[model samples]
Target: MTFSSSYLFSLTTFIYMGAAALYLIHWIFRVKKVGFLATVVTVGGIVIQTVGIGLRWIESYQLGYGHAPLSNLYESLVFFSWVTIVVYLIIEWQVKQRVIGAFATPFASLSMAYASFSPNIEDKIQPLIPALKSNWLIAHVVTCFLGYASFAVACGLGIMYLIKNRFSGASEGIMGVIPDCKILDELIHQTIVFGFLWLTLGIITGAIWANDAWGTYWSWDPKETWSLITWFVYATALHARFVRGWAGRRIAYISIIGFASVMFTYFGVNFLLSGLHSYGAQ
Candidate 1:
């Protein structure tokens, strides 16, 4: 990577960290201006992040081997963070709620910083192996990570929901800053629904890609199994919400568990288990 690109990445990391801190203060103090400032800083960080990714892409070409940056764990994680922020921004805009971004931005910033700084994670662009030399790779990975990002937002909302619920009955100082429990519950449900749709599409795309590349649509690989498990968890959540009239704390708890599965699918399968997706790690 060029020095300029590395510097841009570093700058973005710092901005995100600052934004997260601002958002946290807003949450704790119930200060609207702090949240607004946090949003501004977060947007600035995202713009810098976009430039950084673009510079990395350009640098890849300069190295005489052109490939999208989604090939490895580090790049994927950075892209995942980007997607999470994008999705969170959209939700924040739609709901007019700055509180969720308070939780989401820190996670995004932290993940990006981890990917950028971890010595074990290689930042160099490399040629794709023969197995990965297909268009399906991009589609499959993007969809999967988008799904993961959506669930990450859902997880944040779930956390807020639990906190809101804990203080629902009591007139605590912090409770005044949070939205109503009903609103939190609804937000959690909406995020889960959005995440579930993307996750379903992601899984289907992966299955199709696997069939094209390896002649098997469904192999019980660790990654695949974990993804299936995540699907089931959210599927159950959806059913309970729509069919069984489940809401509030129960659904919030499910969202938490669903996101935990998302983490396991993303990280656990990469490190804790062996599978066809092991090559995903850089």
Candidate 2:
């Protein structure tokens, strides 16, 4: 009768997987009911995952750490999955489309899967380090992951646009369920702009936190350096879209590229490089 954080998280992972599978089936078979069911499953996954995250936060307190569940790779991955679902659902609601779930929910599912099953990631709660003790921890992590989640949704939309365009006439079976390329393109641009703003806030808050913790706002650490790089990549994407009148495949390409940068800034820097933010690798 008792559900621990781990138990709920494990259950949520399977729920996301089911959502992803249902979305894919809906997309491939053009089943309207399946699409509706997919949305329901995704919503269910989000609710359960939200409760699981809350339980984990409480468990941390029980363990004497008393911190938000955003400390280590396992926790970050878990929160990242949650935020990605939230961002995707908002887009689905605005566009009145469920097809994007095929592309978007998989990102959430994979994130949760990795967090729950990865051998290298530890799900145990630990006390925050001196630097992470600041209140900015929540703001910085939340904003950064929100931005990351938005970019992830944009990337999914971009992929959807490309698929719809690529199989325009020949593969009606697959493309028929997808939205128009124009709509996908517009959504991609809108999501990119949203992500860019959040990423900017994330970087700003991180700098403030860094200054408070390390006496410098800009240390050019590996993580900080890569974060700046990732920012510029998206900035250039937006600049090209706005000034050059670039849209369609160009913007789609940039969305994919920008997400690659985001992945690097998030995972690569944490694992492959060393920096003040290396505590995140824990």
Q: Estimate each model's TM-score.
A: 0.95, 0.97
Which candidate has the highest TM-score of all? 2
Off by over 4 Å in 1: 1-3, 243-245
Model 1 is weakest, by summed lDDT over 10 consecutive residues, at 1-10
lDDT of each: 0.84, 0.90
lDDT for residue 76 in candidate 2, whole number 0-100: 95
Compose the digit string of candidate 1's lDDT tens values, residues 1-282.
346666787788788889889989988898889989999998888898888888877877888867777888878878898888899999889998887877788779888888888897877778788778788877888888888888888888888888877777866576676778778778877888888888998899899988988999899999999999999999988888766557677888888899899989988888889899987666
TM-score of candidate 2 against the unseen true structure: 0.97
Off by over 4 Å in 2: 243-245
Q: What CA RMSD would you report for each candidate?
A: 1.6, 1.3
Candidate 2 — which pairs collide?
none
